[model samples]
Target: MKATQKGRSPRGILAFVVAMLLLSGSLRLGSIGIAVASSTTDVDPKLGNVEAVSECVTDAETHELMELLKARSEQISALEAEQEKRQIELANAEATILENLSRVEEAETRLSQTIQRVDGASSKDVNKLTSVYESMKPKDAALLFEQMSPDFAAGFLAQMSPSAAAGILSGLTSEKAYTVSVVLAGRNANAPKQ
Candidate 1:
């Protein structure tokens, strides 16, 4: 009876080992490897016991679990790096949009100033410009004239005292005058007489 009782402890140990295996079924990593290795390995029959086999199997599982966790950590790090790269690219695109907006605003300001200049000039103002042109050096007059609408300059010239107009006309090279004449004849042909 005592001998039967001692043999029964091995059965209890087997039950405990099976219980651990069931509980650890959901645990991650080399579960297949340990089950296969333990089944195939020959036990030193003298040391063979369910407790020892369970402990050895559990140790193998722990190492495999650590390796699995390390792999997952590395994958997570790579994903995080990719996310950061995309965020930086998005920020750079936003900065480029802001820079473009600033440039557009500056261009709009310059256009508004040019509109104001055209709006403020008058027929009298136009006539004064011709006198100013006749008094200046030819190169200075030409440069200033080039900046004005050719039609505006033409009418101003027509209103000037003939002598003053003649002086300025003589100052211009024919080629420069021809270009101004072409401009005045084209899109600005019907431009205000003023």
Candidate 2:
């Protein structure tokens, strides 16, 4: 009976220790599961923070693009304004040039009219002088012509009647008459026959 009691006591103690070890292992597994669930929930919030950062970066880029567009628009407007001002200046210069041309044309017309009037008055005076010389006596006319240039004496003789011109030539010195005759003959040398 003592030997059997000792054997039963050893077996009972071993069984009790195994049961305790199993309970401790189950508690550890439950704690590990709870920690895994809490970590998964925490990871979702971190992912949301990353998404928010991405959106902020996108907004910053959009703002920068809008500012660049605004600057470009302002530059275009300034260029258009400068072009308009240049066009206006060119139009004014054209108007001024046209006005100056009109004034120059008017001055030229007045100058042409003055020249025609002077030419008519000079022609009338020359005719009157020729008639006066022709009415003089042949001796007096020849004396006057002797002192004049050959060309000037020939001009008066051409305007007189043939008889008066012959009388004046007869009274002149032979040298003066010959010189006057030469000038009158050569006057039409350059004229076209046709």
Across 1-194, the per-residue lDDT of candidate 1 in tens digits comes to 56457776767778888989877874534688778767866667688854334434457788899889999999999999999999999999999999999999999999999878876776557667666777777666666655666576666566667676555556566875776556545756677888
Pairs in clash, predicted candidate 2? none
CA shift of 13, model 2, Å:
56
Error of 2 at 105 (Å): 2.8
Q: After superposition, how far is residue 126 of candidate 1 from its true place, in Å?
A: 11
> Residue-wise lDDT of candidate 2 within 1-194, one digit each (tens)?
56457776666777878989999999999999988555544334655632212222357778999889999999999999999999999999999999999999999999889888888887777777777777889898889889999998898888778888888898899999999999989999999999
Tell me the lDDT of model 2 at 25: 93
By TM-score, the best candidate is 2
- Least accurate stretch of 10 residues (summed lDDT) in model 1? 49-58
Which lDDT values do the candidates have, in the order given? 0.72, 0.83
Candidate 1 residue 171 Cα shift, in angstroms, is 43
Cα deviation of 42 in candidate 1 (Å)? 21
Query: Model 1 off-target regions past 4 Å?
Result: 1-58, 122-194
